[model samples]
Target: MSVSELEPGDREFERTPPHDIPAEQGVLGGMLLSQDAIAEVIEVLRTADFYRPAHQIIYDAVLDLYGRGDPADAVTIAGELTKRGEIARVGGAPYLHTLISSVPTAANAGYYARIVRERSVLRKLVETGTRIVQMGYNADGADADEILDRAQAEVFAIAEKRSGEDYVPLSEIMPGALDEIEAIGSRGGQMVGVPTGFADLDALTNGLHPGQMIVVAARPAMGKALGLSTLVPTPEGWTTMGALEVGDEVLDADGRPTRVVAATEVMHGRPCHEVEFSDGEIVVADALHQWRTSVAGVTAVRTTEEIAATLDEVHVIDGPDGRVTKIVDVRPVASVPVRCIQVDNTDHLYLVGRSRVPTHNSTLALDFARAASIRHGLTSAFFSLEMGRNEITMRLLSAEARVALHAMRSGTMQDEDWTRLARRMSEVAEAPLFIDDSPNMSMMEIRAKARRLKQQHDLRLVVIDYLQLMTSGKRVESRQVEVSEFSRSLKLLAKELQVPVIALSQLNRGPEQRTDKKPMVSDLRESGSIEQDADMVILLHREDAYEKESPRAGEADLIVAKHRNGPTATVTVAFQGHYSRFVDMAQ
Candidate 1:
């Protein structure tokens, strides 16, 4: 019978249950057409959410197909249903074929699923109402209030019983896991995890490990500390120790209004200050130092030089368990001899240095030596510690045209050289290259400046000419520890900026003493930790430096002595001293 033809008395028996058959069909059709649609509708509706019993069977079959990581097209779904002897019950192959063809686009599967869910909720409401009415009829001597409460709870339970989520078969789950493994492989696996800005921490705990709690705990305590006081945020306002009177109303952490039955101030002198809540929870006021010291001009109060000593110098306060900072003091000392590397003279800041060969580096035309890093289609920043930006640009022009560096230096360029340089000028001018000749550059300065460059130019690579030339600008107990910290910081900067930092290292006297005169990972100057922190380490070795009579005098060996993810090997590239650059053999 039609639903509209039903009278009030005959409605229960004559009227159809609340449902939209087309919506159920659309949701099923959407899932069958698009493999991605299954995830959208899986949590929103269930087998029972369908109005037609046959459609429920089809939905279950589609879920089974998806769970097994199999396609949910008509053929595969029908095959699974037929294997279970349920295809006949679900209207056979023709019905399965008709399902996917019903939808032109599966993108609206979520909308269709919600419509089906709404209909299901209405049907559940009607079923609940029918049961409540029957309960009223049978309410002979039962408490009317009890019956009403039970009926209300049962109706609410239907709403609470949403379709289950967070369930997936192993077949569907394994593919994403494999994809992540491949991604980790791409990131060299050693640095696959998030960085903690500390190499020691990264080595010990893998840097704020995922799917784990990061608890800061101290080891071997030197002294004890009083407990801390905390500020509890509540609905009426922030909860206070004195405000927890018997009649006072305050909110809980969940923002629910809670009446104060009892609150006690405890451990007043026991090295800890805390207010014990009725809920047995404690709030911490450890942030008071951060709010007061680091932040400036928050409360519209004028702070004197004594209060706002931030201009003096920045301090990096460190602790075993945790740390807080205080930026106070402002004073400048005498200037020292500072040097910058040579590259483009753009106003951007850079961390530049010079890599001088042991004895023969001088008079070898050192200009444009840093520009070789830009060959691989990289937007490079060269921090020149010694060379001027003008000299570097001239060398780059010479190198691009394959002309003699001396010719360009002496303004003795020929007509052909000028023609070649004009063509290369357009290439050089538009390239994402930057040079900074700032002398006495510090690690802090490099980090701040590099972030600005990356934001402005989307910088891809940073070349620090040599690691030994860098200084933290702070005195330490030993130089080794300081260099190691700088190395770790450089590694951290690489990860933060999401770019490869190609830092040249000036090997110690060890390489010169050896008969082979080849640099190794141990030759990285002054810091053993550089080897530990670097994902890849390449050492420059020239046989001709020791033996000029060698057959490959111009050939340089780039020894990949350390590779964290793969085997190390050597690559041969020709270094033309005339052009002051390395040229790939293929080029």
Candidate 2:
């Protein structure tokens, strides 16, 4: 029945999220006549982010015509709708013209679009919140951790659906900061991080203060070790680093075979390996303090020549060792990978990274979502666009239990394996995580589901299996546009929920054409908006996939290619494909 046709409260039992019909009409009406207004309206809302079906259809027409670089007025829009046979569907041509006459000006089109978006968000929140309340009520009968995660996820989902945060005045913020300081003082503490446990550390920093992040990082070896087992290739033959002792032969960076005359002590806290090449330059390799951070925690850096590359190669003859090479070791450059995780005052959005098939990107996504729920005690929701629910469960079980994926799949688990799996089963059963392996799902469905989940669970994080697979609300002319719209919607979803959305992405073979074969931001398959809309992009590069002759045979690179809020760098990780898991590359 038409809502307007009914008397007030005729269907009092019928309930829905809030909406304004005239507002929707006014927005469409404003854009239907003005070509200039279409640009402004499109920025604020997508056709599906709207509440009503007819409004969505009308907005889609406006966007489609605008995209084609055609003029969009009421008459042209009606003609286009008629051509597509949607004229009667959206109340026909009369309704189209009726919208134009309804709006006083096209200038408020953006404002009207915002109103539609706001209503849509509000409605989703109401729907999601009710579901969360029901979940809470069922908590006594349900698994608490799972229910809590779902409930938290649902609430957070609603929070994320809203955009922007109100700025609190310093007066409002400083009192809390000062209160923290006062509490520390009352506890006989001098300052926040002002004095560390160690006296030496306290002297160095005076005190670890507030509003700063301290990272205690594990080191990754680079430079001095890329030539591991040093059967390093030369024109003569493959020679080991140890075999080529003092006065032994080895190849230089330029492929020159030269004798190593002298190995000298260089310096600490610097790339200090100084190996002399007879009648040539000395190779000074500063091998100290080499480390790189990755998405999967920490792992070894790629090359021993990292810091040594900064040095100038020079030939310097000294003593009776004849003409020899000397390496001028240079200090290395440092990178700031991620920022401090501020409890309440900060926010982060991330693109977990990219991968080729079988690189275990999905496994990494699972680990990331699990970490949010388990380690940080935050609720997480995962949307698996590819794998089914049971398969994902097995993988999760394998990862959580540290059991081989093959064992879990084959049901040939040993005694300890079963014990471990049993112990973890309870933990896994209780973890506040929600997973959905719905196939061919649309973005609108994801939003509604996520909002519902958030309302019930207070979900702090959301993960979409992959971007390209997400169904768009409407058929787009170009595949790029379709994916672009999805990417934009995902961004809005993250912002609306006020949580990180780790959406896995598949990379193009562009990485395969290069020697390094590292996925770049450009390698993101179809849409340019994938990069544009994302706050951060982490690219996964597995060297073993690229080369049979690499020490990185067991490793993958977590390349932070685009970080809108922080630094970008590459770190290493170990992908245990059989377990469907990833871990910090162990030393």
Candidate 3:
């Protein structure tokens, strides 16, 4: 029965679902006639988009040949169908010829494919509505709210399907692929990826490239912290602790203005202490907040907690202001919201409050997301499973602006630090860097979000803070197997999006037993699988971290343990722990 002729009260199941037989035939015929038509139609219409079973078989056969770098013409398609023993089901070679004869021109292939897709969408909607109605009728004791939610999900599934990738002809892909290859060749083997800004690392690896999975594994423990209400001196005037942000300026230990490179959000309800100076001036800070002091004519940086514990001894403030105020008291106080900031000063010291209380900030380690995005201008997505969004932003700010991470975190930024930050603020702010810090995320969820981000922002790189933290969300035999599965999926994701995926990993402490304390590829928690799945493996090692007085105290070795396309070597780069960044030694 015709769909238009059916009445509302009549059984709608008797009528045919929405479809355009002529449009389907036209799409197939055009594709069989021209490679250009195949390229156009392949993107729009999948095998199931055809109304007739025979046309679906023919379409599949055409794609099969085209994907194998063979012609998709009538003869080749018929041969493909015969190989599958489906020639008779598709009405043999004669029906294929009929389809070609039916099409006037292959130029209209896209139009025909669109019509086929529209009909297919309509058919899917009908099927979905039918299922939802059945669910409603059979929902014995089910909540109406639950049914409604399911109905919405059912409707949304159609939208998801519409945006899905389908089987495509290589003919449509080869041109761009070849262009990229030629472009790389034209550079005379120069770096093609987002540069790490480290000359030696970039030289060995040719930069971080697309469709590659780079595993960065290391041993743990590296960070620094600070309090909110302390006053900071900026160029404009003194501002409260919580008021400072990235790119602001404040006075440094040398009494010079330096830019603030990084500033974190106010962390609330943190343990704080009050330090009362002999001069009647006072400053409140977190237990971890450091202060510059002298005891017995010896200068050192001590945390508020450390100083408080030793309040019995005489302590004097020896600051850049040249003030020598003896500490009358250091006592624990109420917990309050606190913020921190980092500066670009070598001393990493800044003044706070009307009395110009001297404060100190500690340094931290780094990452490459900001370098890729802000420095290289490549849009990137960072999935930080371990750290929150604020922490990620703080790291990026510190790295890009060359500010001390501890100063940024401790609300102790200098004015020069602020000036330097202001110079790079625009670049950091405008760079297409996205961060997701959803904790304990499953691989499926990460992949889904990455795909959406890529679709929206054209993501060029993806970074997962550490792979061991990710869950597969599936039942598996062992932890190793689960990790292996995640690594395999990560590799597939890289190839699917055609972008680099850097999955941070943790070493199994095997490096600690070694004399050099250097991490090897075998040190990766799930070494066998990760080393197999990754296109490259980079081990980060700092000798000073293991042996405090090592000769290479400020240098880090980026050991390229496994390079699928090149030679393996150790690239020594300056580890600016204070700035939370790595740089070429020349800097």
Per-residue lDDT of model 3, residues 1-587, tens digit only? 77677887675677689999899888988998899999988878777778899987887778768777998888988888888999999888998899999999999999999999999989989988888989989999876654765576456446545532355569757866998899989999788887766777778888888799998876543112334655555555557777777787876643347888887777767788666643324566678877777677677998888888887876776432232345666667678886667888764556555322211101111256766787777878887655557766776788778886556755778999999889888888998888787756777667777777777777888888767667755557977898898899899889867788988876765786677777888888754899999999988777755443357766778889999989999987776655656677765
CA lDDT of every candidate: 0.55, 0.58, 0.72
Q: Which TM-score value belongs to model 1?
A: 0.43
What value does the lDDT take at residue 142 in candidate 2? 61
A best-first ranking of the candidates according to their lDDT comes to: 3, 2, 1
Cα lDDT of model 1 by residue, 529-560, tens digit:
88888876656666754443457767767565
Lowest lDDT sum, 10 consecutive residues, model 2, at 340-349
Query: Top TM-score: which candidate number?
Result: 3
For each candidate in turn, give its C-alpha RMSD to the true structure in angstroms. 24.0, 23.3, 12.9
Choose 1 or 3, whichever is better by TM-score.
3
**Could you give the candidate ranking by TM-score, starting with the highest?**
3, 2, 1
Which candidate tops lDDT? 3
Backbone clash count for every predicted candidate, in the order shown: 21, 47, 27
